[model samples]
Each structure stands twice: as C-alpha cells, then as structure tokens.
Target: MFAKTQAAAPVEAPKATGPAIVPGVIDFNVPGCKPEYPRASLRNEETGTVVLSVLIGADGSVADVKIDKSSGFRGLDNAVRTQLMSGACKNKPGTVDGKPQQTWTKVQYVWKLD
Candidate 1:
C-alpha cells in the first residue's frame, strides 16, 4: 500500500514596502568649509574625493569615523575626520518610521586645489 503524502503549504515571498535607501546616503548633506589641508600638501594636485564611513547617533552627531576610501594622503583623511567631528556637517538622523535611529553613513569629501 502506498503511504499518503502530506501536501506542502505554499511559501510567500517577503513583501517590500518600497525602495530601500541606505540611511547614510539617503540623508547626506555636505558642510561648507574651506579645505583645512593646504593644497601644497596634497599628493594629487587634481581634485580628490575621500569617502568615509561614519557612525551617526540618534542625536545627529558623528559618533565614529573610519576611512572607507583614502585620498592617498594622511593629512587629507585626518582633515575629513576633523570636520565631521567638529559638527560642521549637519546631518539629519536616520529614521524608519519617524523615529530617530543610529546608522552608519558614507560621506564623501572633495578636496581640490585652491
């Protein structure tokens, strides 16, 4: 006699609310300030962009800083961190449903010759 096989339940895919945007990149705003590092010290005279990974708290302030992409110069990297930590950059805290949340943000700093 063949044993009765149980029917499998249908699987449902997870529903997506909408377009998912990275918290950091979604609400990123650059601060206005002159380049702290002199142009003479830059390794490249041409424009350079430094992308940094920064941890922002619910307070909308930089909590941590790490160089995701270096501009090939130590000075430039340090300057970027300095500006961020200085609170010159005003960032809107990330939120899922109108509630502020801590998130890691990727910010780019463009360094150009003056």
Candidate 2:
C-alpha cells in the first residue's frame, strides 16, 4: 500500500505594520517663511488656536486650505491661510507605499502675543 502525502500550506505575504499612510504636515522651518501673528489680532488682544484642513499635493505644494476651526478672529485665520498659500514654506506631502501622495491633514496655528 502507498502512503498519502499532504500538501504544504501556502505562505501569505507580510502585511504592513504601523500606519498605512503617513499624514501630511506643514514645515515652517524655511527661511523667510514663518507664521506671523496678525498685527490686528495682536492689537485687539485676540488669541486663539486655529485648526485648518490642508490638502497638500504630492509635489509638496498647498493644493487647498480650509478652516476647520476658526480662531474667532478673521484676520488671524486669514493670515495663516495666506502664509500657507504663498509657497513660502514647504509642505510635507503624505505618502503611501513609500510614494508621495496628495492627502489632507489637520494643521493648527496659535494666534498669541507675548
């Protein structure tokens, strides 16, 4: 009598660990590219944190910026928006599969005066 042989199980590929996709971020370490506290806001003593939804392109450019949470001061919010859109600083694009990809991320700015 012949003995029956069993087939080996198939091996599965290793899954990705940790975060699947990296979130985009705004880099303010560029020369002449720093967040400026709105002068009007400072004069008015308005201080608050602004939360923005920024869409950064794969090319590290600001595609779109929308205010998720306002700082209760239009001037302050607009200032941050303008600075980000000016291309003065670099925006780190999100990545997937180790490749740059257009992704939206949350950005926060505080409008405070010393």
Candidate 3:
C-alpha cells in the first residue's frame, strides 16, 4: 500500500507594525537635491550606482554618512559625501511614537557620463 504525501503550508511574510515608510529607503520628507559626480577614471568607464547609509539627527540634519556600498570609485563616493555635508539635501527629522528620533537611511547615487 502507498502512503499519501501531505502538502506543506506556505509561510507568510512578517507584517510591519512601525511607520508606513520602508526601512532603509529614504523617507524623511527631505527635499531632493541634485548630486554632482566627479569625472570618471579612464580605467573604469562603466557607470555604477553608489548606495550610502546616512544617519539623520533629531535636528533634521544629516548626522553622518557611511558608504554601505561602493561604486568602485573613490571620487564618486567623496562627491556624495560632500553633497550631504553641504546641507544640500534637506530632510525633516524622523519621528518614532510621536517623538523625534534618529533614523538610518539608504540613498543611491548614480554616476553616468553625459
């Protein structure tokens, strides 16, 4: 006699209970500022995207910037940092449970040749 096999149940994704904004993605109500990229090196002619991790302070300013993912170019990374430090990008402070709190954000910088 052959035994019947039972099907396994599908697992559901965990629901988010926090703010409506997606974690890591920039959602601090910040104004978009145009970023300038440095001239690309001759060796690497291909354009790439740089992912950055930014810490937003309670004062609605960028507290810190960390390069989570590099674009394989130092110049490009520096350019991104400079723009953030210059206060070019404006963002409202993040709130958690009705109180202002620091938040981490991931921003992408795309470098391409004209």
The best candidate in terms of TM-score: 2
Report residue 46 deviation for candidate 3 (angstroms): 5.4
Deviation from native of the Cα of residue 55 in model 1, angstroms? 1.3
lDDT of each residue in 45-90, candidate 3, tens digit only? 7577788888877676778899999988887777877777777676
Candidate 1, 29: how far from true, in Å?
Answer: 7.4
Task: TM-score each candidate.
Answer: 0.65, 0.76, 0.63
RMSD of each: 4.3, 6.4, 6.1
List candidate 1 segments past 4 Å from native.
1-12, 16-35, 39-47
TM-score of 1: 0.65
User: Which candidate number would show the highest lDDT if scored against the true structure?
Assistant: 2
Candidate 2 off by > 4 Å: 1-19
lDDT of model 2 at residue 11?
90
User: Against the hidden true structure, what lDDT does model 3 obtain?
Assistant: 0.70
Q: Which 10-residue span in candidate 3 carries the lowest summed lDDT? A: 20-29
* Candidate 2, lDDT over the whole model: 0.83
By lDDT, the candidates rank as: 2, 3, 1
Q: lDDT, candidate 3, residue 111?
A: 77
